[model samples]
Target: MKCKLVDVFTKQKMSGNGLTIFYDYDVLSQNKMLSLTQEMRQFESIFVSEVLSKSSVRAKIFTVEEELDFAGHPIIGLAGHLHEESGDVNPRTWQIVLNKKSVKVKTKKSGDYFYASMAQGKPEFISILSENDKHAVLRALNLTSENLADYPLEVISTGLPYLIVPIISGIEKARILLPNFEDLLANFGAKFVYIIDIGNFEGRTWDNLGAVEDIATGSAAGPTAAYLTKHQLASVNKPIIISQGRFLGRDSEIEAYVEAKDNVITNIWISGDVAKVANIDFV
Candidate 1:
C-alpha cells in the first residue's frame, strides 16, 4: 500500500505531530492497521478511503497501543493529504465516521500550511477533583497549591477524559516528578493529566502525565475549553484561542471555541494549522 506521512498543526516540516496516511484502504483491515501502527511506531497513524457518501470520510486512526475514535492531527493531516489528491477541498467541511463515533473536520490551505478544525462531541464534566488528589497532581508537577491558579481542578472530556489543572507559568513550573502518580491514577480513573497554562502564553501546556509527554491532544482540549467557558475562566459563548506545544518547542497551536447557552455548554470545536510531509512506501 502507498501511504503519505504528514505532520499536523504546524506550517513547516517536522514541527507538528506526524501521522502517516494510506489513501487506498481497500487493503486495510483492523488487524493490519494495528500491526502497521506498531511497525511505524509513531505516536499515531491513519488510513483514509475514498469518500463513499456525501456526509462521511471513510478513515481509521490508530495509535501504537490501540485504535482511537477520532484524533486531531490525523484528520488535519489526512484532510491535507486528500486536498493534494483532489483539488481545492472547498466545502472543506467533512466528517469521518470511525468505529467509535463520527466527528466533523474542516480544513483550509494557505501557502504550505493547512489549517483544520474538528467538532468535539458533547462535553462531559465527569467529576470535580478532591484537594488531596489535586495535591498529588501538584506534587507530580512539583507545584504547590499556591503556584497554580485559583480554579477548581476539574476532570473533563469531549472524547478522552483528562484531569485539567490550571497552573501559573511554564513547564518549568509544571515539570517535576509526581510523588503520587500511581495513587492519582488509581483514585481518579484517568490515564492522562493535562495542566494547561491558559494566560501567559495563550494555550501553552506543560504535561508530564501518562508517563510521557503528549504532543497534540484535540479531544482533551475541547472539554477543557468548555470547562473554562462554564467556569467563566474564559469568555463564554465565544471562540477561545489557545496556543499549545510551544514549551516543547514544536510550536503547535490548538484553538477551541465553545458554544454555551446560559451556563451550560452546548458544543466545542477545535482548530489548528498543519503541513504536508512526504509520502512513504512500505514493502
Candidate 2:
C-alpha cells in the first residue's frame, strides 16, 4: 500500500495536524483500517478508494478509536495531495463522499503551493446546553461559570457534532481537565467540545472518545464561524481567521467564510494550506 503523510491547515512542514492517506483503500478491510490507524498513532488517517464519479472520490476517515463520517483536516490534506500527484496545477473541484454525506473540495495551485478549501454543508444547530450543563462543562475544564461569555454554549454540526463554547477570557486562560468526557457528551449531546476564544477566534477541541486534543480541527471551524455569525458576533459573509494548535506547538491557521441572509446562515467554507511531508510504501 502507498501512503502519503501531509500536514493540514498549515504550510509549514511540522505544523498542523498530521494525516496519513492510504491509496490502497479497496484492499483493506474495516478492521485492517482501524488497526492501521491505531498503529500509526496519528490524530486521524484517511483511506481513499476509487473515484465515485468523474470528479468525485470515495474516502473513509478514522481515528484510533472509531471511524468518523466526516472530518475536516483530512479532507483538506487529501485534496492537496491528490492534486499534487495528478500534476495538475490548474484549479479544480472534487467531491469526497464519506459515510454520511459528500462534501465539495476545491484545490488550486499557485506557484509551488496547493491551496485547498472544503465547502461544508449547511450549519445544523442541534441545541443549546442548559445553564446547569454549562456549569458542569466549565467545571470539567477546571473553569468557573464566570469564564463563560454571554453567548450560549451550543451544539452545532456541519458534519460531526461539536459543542461550541464561547469563553469570556482568552484561550490562554482556558484549561482542559475533563475528568469524565463520557458524562459531558451525554449531558451535552455532542461528540466533542470546542472552546473558542471570543476575542481572537482561537479554539481548542477535546473529543468525547478520549482524543487528548486535536491539533487543528478544520471540521469544527465551519460550524464555529456559523455560530458566531448567526449570533452577530462575527460579520456575516466575511472571512474569519481561526487559530488553533498553538499550545501543543504545532500551530495552524484555518480560514472560514460564512454567508448568511435574513439572520440564517446559507453557506460555510473552510480553507487551509497543506504541506506534504513524505510518501511511504507499506506492504
Candidate 3:
C-alpha cells in the first residue's frame, strides 16, 4: 500500500494535525483497516478506496480504536492532495462520500500549499450540561469556577458531536488531566471536548479515542463556529480564526465561517492549509 503523510491546517510541516492517506484503501477489509490504523498510530488515518470521479472519491476515516463516520482534518488533507493531482485546469468541487453522508470540498492552490475548504452539515444543538455536570467538567479540565465564563456549555454537531466548552480565562489556563478524563467524557455525552478561549481564538481539544489530543480539529471547528454564531459571540460573515496545538508544539490555524440566509445559519465551512510531509510504500 502507498501512504502519503500530510499535515493539515498549517503552512509549515510538522506543525499541524498529521494524517495518513492510504491509496486504494478499499481493498483492505474493515478489520485490516483497523489494524493498520492502530499500527500507524497517527491522529487519524484515511483510506481512499475508490476515486469515483475526477472530483470525488470514496473515503473512510479511522482512529486507532475504531472507524469514524466523519472527521475534519482528514477530509481537508485528502481533498488538498486530490486537488493537487487534478491538473491545473479549473477549480472544481470535490466530494468525499462516507458511510452516512457525503461532504463537498473545494481547494485552491496557493504557492506551496492548497487551501482546502469543506462544507459541513447544518448544526445540531444537542444538550447543555447542568451546573453540577459543568462543575465536574471544570475539574476534569483542571479548571475552576473562576475560569468559567457565563456562556452555556453546549453539545453541538456539524457532522461529529463535540462538547463546546467556553473558557473565560483563556486557553493558557485550560489543561486536561488524565485522572478526570472519563468523567468529562461522560458528562459531555461525546468522546471529544473542544475548549475555546473566548478572549482569544485559541482552542484545544481532547478526545477519549485512542488519540488523546488533536492538533487541529475540522470536525470540532464547524461546531465551534456554530456555537459562537448561535451565541452571537462571533459574526457569521467574518471568519473565525481558531488556533490549536500550541500546547503540543504543533501550532495550527483553522478558519471557519457560518453561512446564513435571511436569519438562519444554513451552512458551515471550514478551511485550512495543508502541507505534504512524506510518501511511503509498504510492500
Candidate 4:
C-alpha cells in the first residue's frame, strides 16, 4: 500500500506534527495499524479505509502507544492532503469522520498556501480532582501552585483529556516540566504537559512525557483549547494560535478557534497546513 506522509499545522516540512495517511485500510487490523505506526516513527499516523462521504470521511489514527479515540494533528493533516487530491477544484468544505468522531475542514486559496479550518465538536469537560490534587499536578510538572493561572485547575476534553496549565506568559518560563513518570502515566491517565499558554496568544507544551520530547502535540492541544474556553479565560470566535516543537527547533504552529457561550465550549477548530514533501512506495 502507498501511504501519504504529511506534516499538519506548519507549511514548512518536518516542522508541524507528522502524519502518515494510508488510503483504504478497511482490510487492515488494529494490530496492523499499531505496527504501521511503530514503523513510521512519527508522533501520530492515520489510515482511512475510505474517504469523501456526504457528511464526513471515516478513518483511524494511531500513535506508538495505542489507537486513540480521536486525534487533532492527524485529522487536520488528512484534510489538507485530501484538499489537494480531492479532485474537487475550488473546494470550500471537507469533513473527515473517524471511527470515534468527525471534523469538518474548510479551506481558501491564498497566494501560495491554503488556509484550512477544522470544526471540532462540542467539548466534553470531565473529571476534576480536588485543589490538593491539582496542586500535586503542578508538582508533577516540577512547578509550584504559583505557576498556574488563577482559579481551580481543570481537566478538559474535546476528544481527549489534558491537564491544562496556565502559566507565566512566555515559553522561556514554560519549558521546565519533568514528569514524576509513574504519577503522570498511572494517576492522571495522560501523557502530555500543555501550557506555555500564558495570557491569550502563546502556548507551549511537552509531549512524550516519560519518553522523547514531542515537537508538536496536536491531541494535547484539543483539550487545552477546551480547558481555556470553559473557564471563561478564552472566548469563542477568537483565533488561538499556539506554538509547539519550538524547543526541539521544529517550530510548529497549531491554529485553533473556540466556540464557547455562557462558560461552555460549543465547538473548536484546529487547522492544518500541508505542503507535500516526499512520496514513497512500500513493498
Top TM-score model: 2
Write one digit per residue (lDDT tens) for candidate 2, span 1-283.
8899998988779888899999767888999999999888887899999977667889999988889999999999989988888787688898998888988999987665579989996899898988888888787776777778888989999998888999877566665666567667766668877899888888987566444678999889988998888788889778899999998899999999997788677889999998888888887
Query: What lDDT is obtained when candidate 3 is compared to the true structure?
Result: 0.85
**Higher-TM-score candidate among 2 and 4?**
2
Residue pair clashes in candidate 3: none
Model 3, TM vs. native: 0.93
lDDT of 4 by residue, 1-283 (tens): 8778777677877667677887667888889889988898887788887656643678888878788777777777777777666545575787777766767778765443455777767766666667777776666666676666675556666676666667753445444345454355346555455665557445655444535566666666677777766666666678777777766677787777887677566777777577566665767
Off by over 4 Å in 2: 173-179, 209-211
Q: How high is the lDDT of residue 161 in model 4?
A: 69
Task: Write the residue-wise lDDT of candidate 3 on 6-117 in tens digits.
Answer: 8999987887888889988657998988888888877789999877877789999998878999999999999988877776645668999998999999898887788899
3 or 4, greater by lDDT? 3
After TM-score superposition, the amount by which residue 31's alpha carbon in candidate 2 deviates from its true location, in angstroms, is 2.2
Output the TM-score of candidate 4.
0.84
Clashes of each: 2, 0, 0, 3
Clashes of 4: 3
Please state every model's RMSD to the true fold in angstroms.
3.0, 1.6, 1.9, 3.0
Q: Please give the ranking of all candidate structures by TM-score, highest first, separated by commas.
A: 2, 3, 1, 4
